[model samples]
Target: MSAQFIEKYRENAEIYTGSDICKQKSKELLLEINMPNGLLPMDDIEEVGYNRSTGFVWLTQKKPIQHRFTKIGKQVSYDTHVTAFVENRKMKKLHGVKAKEILIWITLNEICIDDPSSGKITFGTPTGISRIYPISAFEVEEDEKK
Candidate 1:
């Protein structure tokens, strides 16, 4: 399959591979979308919040570029408004519970893929998992804004 097709059907193929590959690919794709010049500055991302319950670090773009991921003969759409707001509010509520740092999660309510060649369709439902994380999780460098 072509790189385009691979990228288009990556989520489905993820089950066959480890999450490391998916993380690397996701980073590459997101970098391409936000950093066309190949310069991905750390400041381009902002620290939203953290989820102590899940121990995930959440980060959001300092600027809203194109959030959609696309490929020839394929389409991907995501809605972050509801999840983003809910997570942010929940983060605020956690301030008094435990000072444990947390990262907000962006949940994709729905993911639909249309394959023209095979004339097939695939849909993924959100398991309430996050798509991105703050660099802090790796202890590389803490999110500047956080």
Candidate 2:
């Protein structure tokens, strides 16, 4: 995200820097919002910021990354900077994230779980197209040692 954008929401935002803290904070934010912590598997995180009042969150990493969710046989690419407006079980206006379709990469703009009991999550694109997948596909198992 641009410095100007960050500055606009800096006030009253919970900001964390460094890889360890950023990673932990990001996961915690996801869990708090009723989303899968593993939805974002970026490493070398440089910063993370959350504005609770506006439900805005941003994360920055050392470099862009492409991760394949083996269980779902899908590949997702995350840019160095990602931003979104998140609320309980939903993330909207997402930026810097893309998913590989059969032969093309589609930008994902929204993700949500309308009903947790459905055990399904929906990913939508800017074109109004969407796909549903089992929520378990995005969950990350906690380390037993932790």
Judging by lDDT against the true structure, name the best candidate. Answer: 2
Residues 1-146, candidate 2, lDDT per residue (tens digit)? 46567678879999999998898899999999999888989888999999999998999888899999998999999998899999999999999899999999999999999999999999999999999999999998889327
Off by over 4 Å in 2: 1-3
lDDT of 2: 0.92
Off by over 4 Å in 1: 1-43, 48-52, 55-57, 67-107, 110-146
lDDT of each: 0.25, 0.92
Local accuracy of candidate 1 as per-residue lDDT tens digits, 90-140: 221111011111333232332222322443322222444332322222122
Local error of candidate 1 at 101, Å?
36
Could you list the CA RMSD of all candidates, in the order they appear?
18.2, 1.2
Task: Choose the strongest candidate by TM-score.
Answer: 2
